[model samples]
Target: MKILHTSDWHLGATFEGIGREEDHKFFLNWLIPFLKEQEIVVLIIAGDLFDQTQPSAEAQRIYYQFLLSVSQKTDVKKVIIVGGNHDSPTRLDAPAELLKLLDVFIVGGISVDGKDFSRYLCSLKNEQNAVELVVAAVPFIHEYRLGVRTSMHNESEIHSLFKEKIQNFYFDLADAAEQIAQDAPIIATGHMACRGSELDDAPQEIHMIGTMGGLPSAIFDSRYSYIALGHIHRAYRVDQSNAYYSGSPIPLSIKESNYPRYVQLISYEKGSKAKTVQKIEVPVLRKILEVKSNLEQIHSILLNISWQTPMPPILAISVQVNSYHSGLDLELKNILKNKFQDASPIIAYIRQIPAKSDNNVLASKEAFSLKELTPEQVFLKMCDTYNEIVDENLLQAFRSLLNEENI
Candidate 1:
């Protein structure tokens, strides 16, 4: 049996307000054929199926359409999807009964009691209807769900408690699987931040995940053949453990533009473990490029850049200025229009970054264009620009506001 592992599709995601509908379409178009060719029997999308909880209608359509197409067109026998931190359990679980008709197992979240272990256990059978492989279809787990917290404890102490709770949860699940399995090999899935995985580079995102953290990989039982993971945007193994993150099929940000995005193909047999693995690269259907330099350098690089995608690439241009010019933005836009008259890259962002010494001198520079950083990071930077000290209570309030919906 050949099982393909992938995660963090982030469907309906946009690059600086420019919709990525075409790129996502192209990826699905590419994926369908690959699955057929590889003759994969099980498909595992570990987490983050959509970029947001409430995805656009178009995104939802694409998702359902792809699922329908794959079921009808491919030789794949099963599809497994779990929830990520960005996913809404209710939204995904709503379609559970309907999707089962197409042989898709969607575990959006743990049960209310967190003891419904049976729902997560998926038994993969062979030609004779004999059980071959068992999967622990775990989803993204939050600290609150674990019910481990202490107001009097230090931060480190609290983390240890959470870690113990999480580890115990896995242990209970594994024990249940072991009792049920006579000979079938068991693998598992998870969507959380682990200690040694490469992370997405946005500062605020980093901070947020850091607080939730880097769960120690040692917590997982070594009994499982393979533990497919998600949440981390980078595809890598956690310090040479049985677990591995398949990462996103497409780069989510400019910082991720250079990542070698691919889904893993793992070889499995009727009675053995998931043996070997192979990476089948997913082509970047479009580009998201960022260039930061003096105007002359920026202009030169943009014109000479290589673009081998079907769609016009999304671009972020940062022009370093010694002195501010009111019309620089207009001038740059005009220049781009003239230069790439035939097919121009989409100018998603254009910001003039003055020298650090010049930050406080001009209001424009003080209110800098935000890119890549989290809202909190940008807010702190703004405070730094005005030389203001924020009290702890004020910072906490700001964080609360940041986490609020529709803000």
Candidate 2:
């Protein structure tokens, strides 16, 4: 049987308050037919279904509409959706019972008690209604949910505790999955960032090998034949393991424009232990481009874009200038938007940067005032100045406090 894995839909995503619903709509429109063509028995959305904790009503409509299409238009047996850091557990779980009636399983958060891990075991059956596969729907397991309960100032201590808790959480879930089904290949879903994405703790440790240089493949139990992961916006196989990140369907940020997004198709032949994975490229409905050049060359650089984008692109331009000039952004917007009259580019961002440093300022080191620094950055700088041995934990704690205070 074949299963399709995808994640980080971020439906209602926006850049500088500019709505991103069009791109998502294009993707969803394509996905419905794609699922039917692939004849995928199960569909897994690892996490981050929405871009915001409290998504807009339109965003919610897009989500439910897509699910409705999959239910009525496709022959998919099961639809599994887990939550990411941006998801509000209550919001995702509110209509859980109703979604299940459509064979769409939503797991926003694992129970805090951890006793209901077995409830997360979603069984996927074949046409004959015989159990063929099982999925361990593990969502974003925040450190606070574990023993930490809340963020504290001790960085090293908190990090160590968090790692141990994570390992134990998976171990227990593995135990629970095993008890339910032995012969069925146990596939697991997760929404954690790779070690490379969280490199603040050990910046020196570069992943020259598997899982994009961060997550230990061993963290996942061996029983899981295929581990579908989300949170990292690029599709890659975890080194030394069976885990794979299917990545975001559309480029969410300018830096991600070059990333070729894809959804994964994993197949396991009947009574065969081997699993084969196929990467299906997602169609680019709206293009995005970034231009970093001086003001004199900005227009030429944009004009020289060679990509035959499916649609007129969204542009993020960083213009280097010798000095500040008023109305420069507007001037460029008016000039560039007319370049493609048939499908004009949307100027999403425009920033003017100094082409050269101030003549009087020292070039030895860059300097910025406190106003330019976030409170956490200032705290870290103070720690460094005092020779205090601090780590990411302290920084996280500071941010947690700031979040609580709504700073």
TM-score of 1: 0.89
Residue 389 CA displacement from its true place in model 1, Å:
5.4
Model 1 weakest 10-residue run by lDDT: 200-209
lDDT of 2 by residue, 355-385 (tens): 6665833333334445335566688889988
Clashing pairs in 1: none
Over the stretch 369-402, how does candidate 1's per-residue lDDT look in tens digits?
A: 4655567777888798799898765665665445
lDDT for position 44 in model 2: 97
Give the alpha-carbon lDDT of every model. 0.78, 0.76
